[model samples]
Target: MATGNKEIVRRALEDSWQDPGVFDELISSDYVGYDPALPEPIRGPQGAKDNFKQYSDAFEGAHITVKDQIAEGDAVATRWEGRGRHTGELMGIPPTGMEIVVEGLNLTRLRDGNIIEEWSNWDTLGMLQQIGAIPSATAAQTR
Candidate 1:
């Protein structure tokens, strides 16, 4: 990764959750997230912080460890792992105090030393299924 991109990732990951300043340093004022879960992309650094707070509240201390980073031009692809214990509501589901180890990738597009846009792919269904928050097939397929 380029020095600036790595710096951005470091601030966003290694510090963001613990320190809000990370957002100030690495996120754009007009940021956008292409997450299907959100109807529209977050429009700024504060918006990004807002989204993180909601999810972070659900899984306190949850964090991502980048397994690999592929940087190409203005984009960076990161493969990471997230580990946390359910301690608050998430997606209308109450906490079960279960621990989740989820792995996924996040691809970000940066410009002017800040994240302008992002796309993420993660195991949502698998995670809910693992935590018993959603039903999974057992014994045989349902009709």
Candidate 2:
């Protein structure tokens, strides 16, 4: 069960970025997601699809790579890296055409092979800086 749970999370992290439909299969109906980057918690499979859409719409050719995964009982932890070129609007900021790479970790709880809940922490500030939505530390200090 532990190994299978890890595989489930690995697929979710890698596949869901490009194909939000994957959430329909991997995320449970009661699924909820917590991310500091989000203004509100993500609820249900559709919420997951919308969350991924926000990023996919902003970053063209976006891809996620699962670096590592660990599972114990019904909980899975995954480390992942995402890469893309900012070719579309994001959070009202027009595209900067910058290539960005961001790393994050996700802790997921599964029930009956579907994701029940997940908590994610990622390099949101770094991504913002890369796309010029936020100034970099060096730029801020030099100003």
Candidate 3:
């Protein structure tokens, strides 16, 4: 069951960035996402697909790697790292063509072999700094 859960997440992340339709197979109709970037209770599979599209649209060639995963009692946790080039607008910030790397962890809960809920924590500040939306601390110190 744990392996199945991991595979579901792996495919979901890869496919969401490449082919969003995969969500129809992996996400539960009653799915909900707890993410800081989105409003509470992000509605079902379509919501998940849309969220991924937002990131992928901002970062062309965005790729996510699952560095580690652990599952027990219907809950799976994944540590992930991702990189991409800022080729489109992000949070209204214009494309900077900067390469960005970000790391995060996601905890997903599965019910009846499909993802029902997820909570994610990621390095949004770091990505913003890399894209010049926010000044880096080092840059401020040097100024």
TM-scores of all models?
Answer: 0.87, 0.97, 0.94
By TM-score, the candidates rank as: 2, 3, 1
CA lDDT, every model vs. true structure: 0.79, 0.93, 0.88
lDDT of 2 by residue, 28-108 (tens): 999999999998999999998988888999999999999988889999999999999999999899999999999999999
Full candidate order by lDDT, most accurate first: 2, 3, 1
Off by over 4 Å in 3: none
Which stretches of candidate 1 lie above 4 Å from their native place? 137-143
Instruction: Please report the candidate that would top TM-score against the real structure.
Output: 2
Clash count per candidate: 0, 0, 0
- Candidate 2's displacement at residue 80, Å, is 0.6
Off by over 4 Å in 2: none
Per residue, candidate 3 scores C-alpha lDDT tens digits across 1-143 of 89989888888766667778889989999998898856666779888777777788999889988899999889999999989999998778999999999999999999988999999899988999999998999998999
lDDT of 2: 0.93
